[model samples]
Target chain A: MATARAADEAPAPAAPAFDVKNAFRNICGFCHEDYGRKQGKGPQLMDNPNSDDYLFNRIRNGKPGRMAAFGGAFTDDQIREIVVFIRKLKPNENP
Target chain B: MKRHSRKAITTASVAVLAGLAFGAQANEGILKRSANDWPSYHGDYKSWHYSDLNQINAGNVGKLTEAWSHVASRATRGLQGFPLAVDGVLYYSSPYNQVYALDGATGQMLWTYKQKLNEDLVAKQTHSPYNRGIAVGFGNVYMGTLDGKLVAIDAKTGKLNWETKLVNSEKLTVGFTGAPLLVKDKIIIGSQGGEWPWRGPIFGVDAKSGKEAWKFFVVGGNEGTASDRRDTWGGDSWKTGGGGGWMPGSYDADTDTVWWGTGNPAPLYDWAGDEWMTKGPRPGINLYTSSVILLNPDTGELKGYHQVLPHDAWDYDPASGELMLIEQGGKKYVVHPTKAGFVFVFDRTGKPVNVYKGVDNINFVQDIKPDGTLVGRRDMKEGKHGNLCPAIAGGYSWNSGAYSPKTGLLYKVGFEWCMDLEVVKTTPILEPMAQLNIGANFTFQPPKDGPARGHIRARDPVSGKVKWEMKFKVPPHGGLMATGGNLLFIPEADGWFSAVDAATGKVLWRHNNGQGHNGGTITYMAKGKQYVATVTGFGSLVGDAYGELWGEPWVSMPKDAGVLKVFALK
Candidate 1:
């Protein structure tokens, strides 16, 4: 649950932390795994860190009817870290 | 590994363990028989449609033509329930609870078992529809009615052996939609009420005497705990929870256990009651819904459990596809493809070693833990709707999936799609009350970009990696089979039959079967030659919303599209 924020308190800024292989794993379950559509227990992700609104709300609030929530277990800054990582995710020439 | 990427790799050992425990053999195409036999619905309980016959390889498949086709008497309003082939005799069930016995060699009807559908009984049922298929064991054929009655017929003669009513269709509107899976002497079946407020369960009946053997519920109610899911809603959705084992279960003879997945929780659209599902993983992993549940064939004991969809609010039921068993490098495993667009590999212990997201365009959760437990985002946990990755129907739906031992690859088919689903509560409920099922207008939404089409690919089940990939303009559906001739037989929804190179994932040959396929494809050796068969008819969730999502062309009229096309190698 999002608590009422004070004027002094604001959402944390994004962190520079990122998994080095972010892009290669952007569509981690891509290609042959599900013939591409078999997303398994989890849905696919984007490489574009700019896909954050779609990412945070998806990861923080959780997309209903499809995904569940995780904001409580994870800190807003930690989530932003993931969003940053996703934005830079790009497939290398070969994994 | 990617930070948020869910690992879909399960070591071969885990798959074998899950396979042994569930009594389902490796789906590596080992337990596969000649395509002609169609011995088991999934060809010998293992659910692997792999055939040894190489006559119809890519080399000769181009010359292949449809030898014969048997169209259904009436257009199928919603045809699900696959057929059973034994000793060249094909036994199939049609909508309205009708069963037909056919000759596998020639698409000829040898006998027909019209269930004398009790319209009055069905009318009273929440969603009285028809039979899925039947099981043949102990010299008798077992079939369940849309109204929840289990009937046993003699194998040789179309005579009724015994009948047992499993559920009162009026009170539950729950019945069997999956073909009866025969394990040793027991005929295992499940009921359908996913769309309704009926209890979820898989029922086992004595194959010989038609006696009630055991019943394993997907949702818990008997324990009498409000915290227990079955008591949550305290209403029909709570009571019904739609545990229909809509898809046939896979049995591993070695394990003596049955591996089956459960359907979606009821109340169709609104999953307010299925709270846990809205959260990370629903409580109890919904017992059986979207879970790989193990049942003791003899006692029907629920030995172990693993959930594929926790608190399934999106209707991404794991009940559709088949459970394939594979053994890699001496490690055995249970291979399963879910409607949620996942190609999951689990250890024999039912532990999630790895889970990989295959869909390129889903937007639900970010990842899965090493234990196979799902980690949901905080916001999406509660029953609400938005840009859920898979539109409940998931990356893949009620079609078949396959594996080729020769290449050690798994093949899954489907349209990569998602939607903006908003679960609004329905008032007064729709009639005839739809057999106490849940109701949801699963609105169709395409991916952020690209055409709304599907594809089929050959995958490395072990690493959750892709070996080769191919695309289809129309959404793809059905199971796939790889053969000795280095070919993959794929039935498509684009009215074409195809053969792809087993190793490279190349589309080597194609045939216009004339219609899209719904069920999986199977191959066998008949008359010293190899022949392939696929069931082309729509059923399950698609039939429920055929008109809305599929539109007019792919639409289903009360009875419009139903046919079984059998092809042979010259």
Candidate 2:
């Protein structure tokens, strides 16, 4: 096996503030359809009955076999932003 | 060091003799495909998915009854692997790299082997756990694992002989869900890719020693690749251009070439519109991705290639379909179905012979000419676009169709669906473990002509003329099998396994396996008796949409369950 690359060991550069809408469209929207306003492969995030803590944990550590864990891809703050985005989701009246 | 060299020489001598004996059998078994064995993933190198065993014909197919059943453990996304039979023993794989050897006639479990996997990585993956199939050759069963390793187990003892890590799955977040194709002395396997932002690679490994011999990247050509070919991807976009030969393609022994179809580039939906040639997440045609490539099995060298969809922005992968080798009027042709609802016919030299629509819902392009040029491109911008024909699930998903030499027709499935998309521009994530770079949010919808549905069509593969078709409310997401008995075995997405008369699309026998079918089916002779075997289960990425698109059975179907159902004349 090859040794770990120096790039991997080096400290990660500071990233821009997470954009929940774009991120959701890129990743989460694969299963959660309509920007989470309607259900598709996953449950609709709009008007969700789950609590903040539930959403946060689920996003970080996903349900096995049901959803992929995004914790490695997203920070805690980013996941919280996603939870907030879910809370604010509403039907696109114009769309 | 001197003593070690002496021992290595001794081992090499023994391996060569064993290889000589095994290579002869493997070549004959795979190239000709004995009536008693379903040796390769495509049944044979022709990718016919057909068996010549005719004990159970259409006249007596009604007398067929369940011989036995084996429920596989940890069938996470249902049993999605094709079962291979050799002699009287049956070998198959399930989720989590679980391999099982069974008595093909009795379903008696002989032994089971499960690979130790990196559970954490599997949990973070969108496509995980399930193993599509296994290849048996040289007295070992070879399977590619979810944790980026190709493992070979003793076909008899079910013990590990060797395990070689081929990919950095912990970092790339994708591994092998497809089966490895055993060609000659090498095990050829491709990694899972498409949305992940990394160069998808297909590896050629030494079958005897489990050592990686060579690797070829499908996204961008390797160092040995021509400079002009490597320049197909603009700038550094090729560095993370997602493409993979995710499925097991067939071989043309006459030409001594292995044909493989590659996945689409990453960030599936490009928002560059018509400026895609010089702008977007990845500019240029993205060379080998979304194309049919021919490789030399011995050297892993690119022999020839045809880019089916140049600058494939719609995520329509040719990788999902089977590379069927057919001959007509002394001309050899390769019939490949692209996920974008079109079937591309290519000659032995990788030149387009013809291009035709497999599904009616396509509007991604006004037409793909016989010369393989895109006309009237509907490149979407960074906004909402309606009626994107053939939803993300694709017109043709990963499951394969069967071609019958007897009927001279191809039996395949075509999905009818569309989607409304909202393309978003996002940065490619590659550092802390790769993530899906879909670049779009879409909802599944019915096509303009009808409700979202599927159908089975018997057509002239080269000419694209439909002889007959059978429609379904929802597409069956399983591999098809045709037999010399003049029967077509279809594993339905709604839990019904039916045998239809190949001559006339009439259902002769039906059995409910109690779950949706999304894997493979084949017919083989075990203990001098003809038997049909199919893996039953559902919950594939494509089938996952069924719960929301349709109600009832799909919503209630268990995603983590599967059964290997076998049948024979009672």
Candidate 3:
């Protein structure tokens, strides 16, 4: 098997521009469902009554037994972007 | 034609008989398990998931009552592990790597062992904490931890024998959630992959002393090795091709081969359409993933394989189903169900013998031929596609089906649902920590045939001839078990555990365990008394959708609770 590259051997590349839309599709949409417009595995996010701080913290430090923490995987700014995306979610006209 | 020649023939026959008996014993209680023990993950090497204990038969199944129950602590996503019984002791695992040894008849806790884990790493994982099952042999109980270690606990006394760190889960963010199969002297376990951007590796570890033996990369096979099929992927796409044998497979003692299934490739949905061979994110056939792999357990060598879905863009993994070893008309066939809702039958050599549909709504491909070719392929470009059949949750989930030799039938549960998908082009997340590489957003919807529902069907393993079926409002997330008592035990998602006639599909007995079932059901004999034990809880990755889809008990069900409920005749 190919060995995992050592951190020192390969310099870290620049972080790409965060695409919350595509990011939701790739990760959060699995449980959020319908781009957060509808409830599925998790509650619907489009009209969620929770505050933005609550959403950001929930995304960063996930609730135990319910969701996984993304603090390590995503930057704080990216998590805030996710909160904004959740706030902007609306029902798809086509759907 | 002399009297002396005839005497030599009789002596040779005796020697052959003795050889057969020794071979059975040499397998070390796996091939020929005792009536009281459920030693291996699939109950035996055949993956029968059936017990021969008939002390509680269909006639007296109505008198079955709960003997005792043991509640597991910190059952985050519930107790998903199957219990193993040997010599009146029941060994089971719950979430957070907690193992308990109980008296099979009394449910009295003898001892418990809790492994110290990297809690921070586990908290960051998507499929965290829940242990599926364990293996028991060589005076030890083997379990795979969520933090990427395989530990052996002494079976008689709950003490750590040894622990081996196999995967670099801190970097890759994926580890072992499935049980290890005790093949001879090696503990073979597969890592969780598919959606993660990593070459999922299945390891063969020394069972006696927790030492790393061999590893087989299911993604692009071992790097630079000929016949590893690394050429199946384009460029460096194989580096994160995402293939794993996340579930435990069975052993075929006749051929001395392990028949395991592999998960699908990363970036589950392809956006290249028909130009997949050259233009896709990870082009070529992506060999070995979504396939039935025949392996040499001792060396982790790929013996032969049949890719069930070539270029599987639907996340239809063959790894979810148990490879049921069935013999029909003198031909031994491995019957496997892919997540795409079709069943493939193969010979001992990994050659496809037959293909049949297990569920009704399957439009991912128009048809999968008996030769394992996908016809009328539905390759989606980067756009919205309507009503893709057999939704993201799959026509079949990771739970296993049961096959019974008594009734000559295979009992399986299948879901009927479709999805509205919008395929997106996403970049692989491989730096610092790996994340899910799903390339599509989808929502569950009812199939054209009817509402979204599930059914348990008893069918011929080779022919797919349905004998009978019982439909449910919601699918059962747990595994099924059949018995020689002519009863099929099904733990439903609505907290009901029922015993139905294996031949008739009639519910003979039912009991509510207060939560949805999402783990395993098993039967074993303890002190000459037959007992049925099942793990009950809720909140699996797929099962988490139950609240919105069917909103009654599930909306109010507890997710962090689990119990091992054992029953016997009153």
Q: Is candidate 2 or candidate 3 better by lDDT?
A: 2
For model 1, the docking class works out as: incorrect
What is the per-residue lDDT of model 2 for residues B203-301, given as tens digits with 9 covering 90 to 100?
998887787988889977787555225466766677778998889988899889999999899889888887777677777788788988899999889
Q: Per-residue CA lDDT of candidate 3, range B6-116, in tens?
A: 111123322332221112232567777777778777888889899888888889999999999999999988878899887678889999899999999899889999989
lDDT of 1 by residue, A1-95 (tens): 12111223232222244332321122222111121122222333433333567777766665321232435434677567766655543443122
What is candidate 2's lDDT per residue for A1-95, written digit by digit as tens? 11111222222233366667767877898999998888898888898999999999999999767898888888999899999888888786422
In model 1 chain B, the worst 10-residue window by lDDT is: B1-10
| Weakest 10 consecutive residues of candidate 3 chain B by summed lDDT | B1-10
Candidate 2, position B373, lDDT: 85
User: Higher-lDDT candidate among 1 and 3?
Assistant: 3
What is candidate 1's CA lDDT for residue B547?
40
Instruction: Choose the strongest candidate by DockQ.
Output: 3
| Candidate number achieving the greatest lDDT relative to the actual structure | 2
TM-scores of chain B alone in all candidate structures, in the order given: 0.84, 0.96, 0.95
Candidate 1 Cα errors over 4 Å, as ranges: A1-95, B1-36, B78-81, B121-131, B221-238, B268-285, B378-384, B425-442, B538-540, B543-552, B555-559
Candidate 1 residues B81-124, lDDT tens each? 55666556666766666677777778777777666555544443
- Judging by TM-score, tell me the better candidate of 2 and 3: 2
